[model samples]
Structure formats: structure tokens, C-alpha cells
Target: MPTHYEGSKKERIALDSFIKFMRASESVTSKLAHGLADYNLTMSQFGTLEVLYHLGPMCQKAIGEKLLKSGGNITMVVNNLEDRGLVSRKRRESDRRFVSVALTEEGTALIEEVLPHHVELIVEMFGVLSDDEQQRMGEFCKRIGLAAASEEES
Candidate 1:
């Protein structure tokens, strides 16, 4: 079964493009999630580890901001990672109220092992697009994201 929409030409174009964009995002995310499964990681877990790996120690609030996750959600993710001994949280000396999360040695090793293959997978996924096309697509996405963010702010 297919969805059928009756609209003006511009409206139809916008609807079709939005549908395709959503489908593409889902497809890519699903593939990546499957790829992460062998490591016993969810997408959020991997994202949290990756951020800690690259950014060093950060407070939970800052991590949530970087990952665009809610405070409670970030706390849960950090708790899970900490349970696995992949991440550790320490109270800030200057601010005992804040806890900073950092990758453990084990976490660093795990992400280092996984990141290269993940990059390869990403490259392969986008291989169908020429370099220039990829660049143009990135630019277009940035513009759209910025506009959406601005609208949210307004």
C-alpha cells in the first residue's frame, strides 16, 4: 500500500521530499545500529562513548547538550555506561553538585577499536554520492537544520 496525498504542486514536492528524507535517515540509522550490535551497544551508548572519547571529561549536562538528549535520559545512559565500567563519573572539585563523565581506559580501547570500522561503514554508505554531491548535500542539510533551529528559538 502506498500513501496518497492530494495537494498543490509545491505542497506535494515538499511532502515527498520530507518523506524521502525521513526514510533515508531511518535506513541509515538502522544500518548503523545493526553494525553496533556486535559490541553490545545501542546507538545512544555509542554516541555517549564517542563524545566522551573525543571531548575528554564533561559534566552530564554538557554531555546532554552535545548529544541533544534530555537530562534524565543522559543520566540513565551514563549510569548504564558506568555500570559496564566503560565510563566513570566524579564530583567536580570546584562544584560538588556537578559530576563529570569520562571514558575509562577500557572505554577508550573499545571506542578506538570500533571507530575505524564505523568510519569505514559510513564511507561505504555514502559511496554512491560523489564527493561534490556529498558536500552539497551537507550544505543543504546545514541550512535546513539552521533554519529549523532558528524557528524553534523564535
Candidate 2:
């Protein structure tokens, strides 16, 4: 059955494109989340680990910014990782009030084991797209993200 939308042609077209974009994002993320489940990690936890793995220690606030997560959400993720002995927070010598979170040896080892497989999964998921199509898609996403960020700042 064809779904009918009540809107001007341009508005309906824009809405249809937005819906497709969001559904594509959700579908990709759902697949990736299933892949991470074998390691008992949520997407947020994996994202945090990936950032700390590549970028070294960062404060909770910094991690939140990098993940585009709220402070409370990041705190919860960090606490869970800490409980699992995958991460540790150390107070700064110069500013004891500020604590930086870093991956533990266990965390480093875990990410090392999982990252390659994770990358392979991503590659497999995007294999339907030609290299040029993937590149163009990336460029479009970046442009959209930049515009959204600028709107947020205004």
C-alpha cells in the first residue's frame, strides 16, 4: 500500500529524504550493536573505549564532548567500565578536582581484540556501496553535520 503524506511537494520530498536517512542510520547502528553484544558492550561503552584507546586519557567532560553524550550518561558508562576493571580515573596532580579516565591494561587488550573485527563488520556493511559512492556519502554526511553544529551554536 502506498502511504500518502499531506504536504507541499517540496516539504514532502524533504521529509521523505530525512526519514530514509534516519532509518538507514538506525539500521546500520542496530547491526553494529549486535556485533558488539558478543563482547558484552553497549554502543556507548564501545564508543568510549574506542576514543580512549586511540586518544589516550581524557576527562569525563572531554569524553562526553567527543561522544556527543550528556555528562551524566558518560559518567554512567565510565562507572560501568570502571566496575569491570576496563577503565580507571586518576585525579590530576595540578587540579585534583579534575579526573581523567584512561583505559586499563585489560581495556586496551579488549579493544585490541575487538577493533579489527569491528572494522571488518563495518566494511562488510558498507560493501554494497562502491568506493566512490561511499566517499560521496561521507562528504554529504560531513556537510550535514557541520551545518547542524553551526545551527546549534547560533
- List the candidates' TM-scores in order: 0.95, 0.92
Tens digits of lDDT, candidate 1, 1-154: 1237888888888788888888999999998898899798888889999999998999988889999999999889999999999999998899898888999999999999888878888999888899999999999899989998999988
Candidate lDDT scores, in order, read 0.90, 0.93
Residue 113 of model 1, lDDT score: 89
Cα deviation at 78, candidate 1, in Å, is 0.6
- Judge candidate 2 against the unseen true structure and give its global Cα lDDT, from 0 to 1: 0.93
> Among these predicted structures, which one has the highest TM-score?
1
Model 2 ranges with Cα > 4 A deviation = 1-3
Error of 2 at 144 (Å): 1.9
Model 2, span 114-154: residue lDDT tens = 99989998999888899999999999999988998899988
* List of clashing residue pairs for candidate 1: none
TM-score of predicted structure 1? 0.95
Name the TM-score of candidate 2.
0.92
Candidate 2: deviation at residue 78, Å? 0.5
